[model samples]
Target: MRRNTGVFIAFAIVFCWFALLTFLLQFPTVFTEPWPYILLLLQTHLYTGLFITAHDAMHGVAAPGNIKLNTVIGFVCALLFAFNWYPRLLPKHHQHHHFVATEKDPDYHGGNFWAWYLSFLKQYITWPQMLAMALTFNILTYFFPLENVVLYWMLPAVLATFQLFYFGTYQPHKGEHNAENKHRSTTLKRNHVWAFISCYFFGYHYEHHDKPFLPWWKLYQEKDRSFK
Candidate 1:
């Protein structure tokens, strides 16, 4: 229970920070020459956090025992990404865990990185969602500078898709796996800081597959043993 509360508070803080940054970036004066690009990089990580949070909820680790709250949090975080379908993702993710790297896994892509990413996007992105995101962007652009909207909100979300796919799915599941091992995943051997910055230690895919309940933030602590 304490862990769940801590996870909730941490997520709230990071998400609120992202929102505040987005709101502030709308003022043209705030984004001077390089600052805008710098913030975009930071925003990308924060946006990735939103997806990671929703992913945690799918595993029942974000707000344990409270299905309604978990669903609400997951739904909202996913919508913020403009490409998520959390309810649908829950079952699909479970299937990935059950039949990882096999044809039965929704995330399996035969180790083709680009193909895997596009296939991942195809699962959730639909015309209705695209139209809704476009409408929302158009409406928000009326109040915020179009550049600000694109840089801070839109680009970060897009970059985060790659970030999540690369760190969470591709690198881990790529290459050959021994058929004897049920969990077909590999771990990165980089130091903890790089691992955290890269994908919040998701490169420690073996530990994640072994213990999916530990929220992503905590994955960093178990890095040394997990990595090759």
Candidate 2:
């Protein structure tokens, strides 16, 4: 049931992103009110959801038994989220898991926030991705208001990178680990609501390094699991 639900949520996340965009991209009076700022934050969150779903796909949790369907969902999610290429993200993510905070971890760059974020971007961003985004942006302008596209579409995606980086990667992996911290990872103090709002419970990250096959939605359960 957990695996089946994850597969369904994977598609739901992708659909919600597009459904929200379709409404917000032409939303009236976007910049004229404080409510639109809330919309921006919500959109940014959905954008992060896109990446989180793709990350689950990489772990084979998003569509456990169907390889082709799983990869397709991930490919679509990543492509829509600023044209990120799923194939490229696969190996680097596993490398991060294998190496944790070591030099071989593509997501790590010591404890400096700026340095680590730049490294994270460099590890994932490519010229072709940038070019594809640019082309898509230009094409969208012909159909949607430039203000709406910039605010609802582009800005949230940019903010979501910071959101994902800060919560999912930087906080969890930065700084020194205690002697018994086998994964060299840190789990956030228990706050299930904030954990989900922050990064789909990715802040329960030590549990993640301990059980990589679990989907992002299940991290909270792992975070609260009992031991003998």
Candidate 3:
């Protein structure tokens, strides 16, 4: 089987980044200073990255030709982000691709943003997972500063759900873009910085539908391609 070097690099980078953020959050001075808030924001993006990495695995591109490795990577990433059920996510995500923005799509929502977000949460959030997360939070806070645990570990995962919804799901598939694109998705106009910041260029939603195999880091290259 051919090696997916890029996927390996992307996974390594995200894992190392998560580790770095954990280290900074654990440090006494960093936890006490104003930097923890900024780190929390950065960690939110990293959490988004982990989700996207798992997403890439779902498409079989993250660790191409190595199903076991891909599954392990996706499961670990999702688990770290407080989502424990990768098996449940995998099939539902495939259904979303097949019936995108329609009633059949697990993520589909034709109404208000909050309502849609609530629906999305309802489908995935489980009682056991919440209890596990709460228990884990209690244990962590016993060892680390409560502020550090809340800001660095808890808040980012919560904010990342919003980030994923707003940038990846709601913004690209809402209103005008939905009407114009057959897939009910549209690409964000070229803006490299924001492109990278917002869901790793998943703002380029149409391009993603066209080439689902492309990894998140390479999605921006589609901006230059003539879709005609």
Candidate 4:
């Protein structure tokens, strides 16, 4: 099969799985019992994983070509997570790569652990006015008992949006990942499994920072021999 064809097949499977889970969650019988709630939580995380995959697709990491397709897929995925406005935020993300972690970057920050922690709040929450709008939708989920929409659908949608914003915008180009900070970069390896699973192999971020065009599957191929 063609590369794009394979990617679409993979995406379809994940999408179907998410749909099935959502369907099952809609019936109260599924969540009326403790075991069902546990299952629902697990499915919620899976939905988050699917959204993450959708995110990689938007970034052209999953499949290239067709800008319209990318945009539509991203919007649908974001909408599923209750944050469909993500495409509007892409310019800021794109700028982060061009500027890296330098002063010119909107996301730039010093590597001092405490400084980075404090700066993250400011960087991520830049538009306080928008927070009210964003929170309103999320808060509604708490009051509403739409089992599938709230637990399986909306929760993952929210997590995916936050993960994409953090990993895509902040983690990859952070000053801590700079070439001069080899020691800090070493920590990436320790968490490779989670990165591979949660971010669709985006956790190999150092390699990605070096070669942005490479696909996620090929990221491990570029891993430094020294690390092994």
Best by TM-score: 2
Please report the candidate that would top lDDT against the real structure. 2
Report the lDDT tens digits of candidate 2 across residue range 71-145: 998888888889998999999899989998999888889747887788888888899988888888999999999
lDDT of 2 at 42: 92
CA displacement after TM-score superposition, residue 155 of candidate 4 (Å): 3.3
For each candidate, the alpha-carbon lDDT, in order, equals 0.79, 0.88, 0.80, 0.57
Clashes of 4: 1
Candidate 4 per-residue lDDT, tens place, 1-228, comes to: 465762674467467756666465555654447866665555655555555555555567555676666666665654444443555545655666677667766666766544665575455443542574468546655655655556655565456555654564446555445458532333257455676555655666667666666665566666654357
Q: What clash pairs does model 3 have?
A: none
The sequence of per-residue lDDT tens digits that candidate 1 reaches over residues 77-175 is 777777577777789999999999889988888846778899988876788788988998898789888887788778887898889888889888988
**Candidate 2 lDDT:** 0.88
RMSD, each candidate, Å? Answer: 2.4, 1.5, 2.4, 5.2
RMSD of 1: 2.4
Which run of 10 residues does model 4 get worst, by summed lDDT? 182-191
Stretches off by above 4 angstroms in model 1 are 29-32, 225-228
lDDT of 4: 0.57
TM-score of each: 0.89, 0.95, 0.91, 0.63
